[model samples]
Target: MSGSREEQLAAWTAKTKRVGFRQRNWSVVRWLAALTVTLLLAGLAVSLLDYPPALAAACWVAAAVTGAIMLIWFFDPRRFRARPSGIS
Candidate 1:
């Protein structure tokens, strides 16, 4: 069911407060997940050598992509924007 405008705004405000408090924390979770997947794929690639080279190549490529994402998430400039103290 659709909620009223006031109710919706209140809910949004509460969620924003929670999200702001938890900011940058979930970045750790993403980095961990990326590293885990990359390591697993790298191991598989080593084990699969001389077999399906294409599959290993694909896994290595996926690892590289995720590695780039992890780096970007850790070093992104947009993540550090300063909030204005006064409302315009």
Candidate 2:
């Protein structure tokens, strides 16, 4: 609060970058475990419902594509900021 606006901005920027870096630095094992669990759960639901093979495969593919899209959207730093109202 006591510093110049530029100093405050710089501090905020550094803190944001540090958080983003930490998010991106997650271990491979952790990533794999999360992915495995998600896929396993999806597969389980598909199996328990007794869906046909083709339908089950389609469902799996759709889930994967959707998940990828969601992950990309979630991790994009720009998504954290509000868009200007007139930009649309």
Candidate 3:
């Protein structure tokens, strides 16, 4: 019956909806934070090797801010609605 076919399509579409969306959101945020933490830790590690404390602090702060940005924007990219490259 047509009703049965509709139900099957709906069932399959629901599974896809439950799948990629949350994982993609999580993956972007998680990896961004990991990268930021790595940068901060690397900066800290190199400061004792004469990288300059001010430079190290700046690196960590920059990383933290970038990570925070990713966290905020991970929900939706369309919300930004602008060309980062400045090309309309």
- Which numbered prediction scores highest in lDDT against the true structure? 3
Residue 21 lDDT in candidate 3? 31
Model 2 C-alpha lDDT per residue in residues 1-88, reported as the tens digit of each score: 8799999999987876656532342344356447655765776677789876666676567667656756775576654544334532
Among all candidates shown, the one with the greatest TM-score: 3
Model 1 reaches what TM-score against the true structure? Answer: 0.43
10 residues in a row with least lDDT, candidate 1: 79-88
TM-score of every prediction relative to native: 0.43, 0.40, 0.49
Off by over 4 Å in 3: 1-24, 74-88
Output the TM-score of candidate 3.
0.49
Model 2, runs deviating above 4 Å: 1-43, 82-88
Task: Check candidate 1 and list the clashing pairs.
Answer: none
Model 2: lDDT to the true structure: 0.62
Q: For model 1, state the Cα shift of residue 61 in Å.
A: 1.0
- Arrange candidates by TM-score, descending: 3, 1, 2
lDDT (Cα, tens digit) per residue for candidate 3, span 1-88: 4569889888777776655333245566777888888888878887878977888888888888878888776766553433234322
List lDDT for all candidates, in order: 0.66, 0.62, 0.71
